[model samples]
Target: MVFRPPFEEFEIQLVEVPAGETVPAPTNPGPLLLLVTRGAGSAAASGGAAASSKLLAQAELRRGSVAFVPAGTTIKYTASGAGDLQVWAAAVNAKVFAPATAEEAAAAAEPALVAA
Candidate 1:
């Protein structure tokens, strides 16, 4: 078994979503893989206005749940109960150092993840 990437520029983020709080992370530049390691919660991918956004996808997260977040999508992690929710997020083909662009901003503003 072997895995190969065109370039080796990615990030593995150890995220902790506190109990009963919504945390907003920056828009991902590439595909993202998420795995819940502890506690319970839900991962939501949304786009559009902040006042009234639409959910692209919602996945129930547990101790061993997995979710996929696409590029140019904004994801929010929320923890339930009294303990924090921990998850490991791995971004592939990620351009973490790239500057933000107007097109990118607009794409993020009107995100729509389609399932095939």
Candidate 2:
């Protein structure tokens, strides 16, 4: 499926991931702004561990906090502590750059894919 931004300026998706769940990775091309509203989670890029890196700009985000993530950066998130992992994912797209296909996104997200 194509990941088309919902809004004209940016798309805001209020996502809720259950406990012990982790978001795999993006399957399209777009900048993501993840605003944590409740619970705890860890974000890691392709060459990092989900719980070992502090790359993602974090915030208390209990009520109001936000973090901006650039495009082409593959990220994996694992929820910690209690409560549901709630995040507001803002997707932005520029006309100059087209979205990546599912295959491309998968290849980019994987860390050990041998180049052919």
Candidate 3:
């Protein structure tokens, strides 16, 4: 689904990871909020020059667990236990809500994925 706010646009995606599977880290140019819909898992995020991956957080992921990932951060997701992990992700454009100076607008339009 799609959500169009006055200042930003967000896309909702359903992500599923089978048990014992690890998904590669993904970097977003904006912020993202993930709500767990089923199962359990752990997320690891890292940013800045140090660049070392650390446990961002873990959740039982029943029905109300939510995870927030800041802009420009790299996050890796791993599914735990025998049940599949399902998450509803809402990704928002940071620039839309927090625009930079006029000169930076052009550059901010492009999205960059930082390596984890």
Best by TM-score: 1
Q: Pull out the clashing pairs in model 3.
A: none
Backbone clash pairs for candidate 1 read none
Candidate 3 lDDT by residue in tens digits, 31-91:
7788988878776667731154344543345556897776777666678867887777788
Per-model TM-score, in order, reads 0.65, 0.56, 0.61
Give a tens-digit lDDT track for model 2, residues 20-71: 7877666325667778887777655553231344654333344355666666
Badly placed stretches (over 4 Å) of model 3 are 1-8, 48-62, 93-116
- Better lDDT candidate (2, 3): 3
Worst ten in a row by lDDT for model 3? 48-57
Cα lDDT for residue 67, model 1? 77
Give the distance in Å from residue 115's predicted Cα in candidate 3 to where it truly belongs. 48
lDDT of each: 0.74, 0.61, 0.67
Candidate 2 regions with alpha-carbon error over 4 angstroms? 1-7, 47-63, 93-116
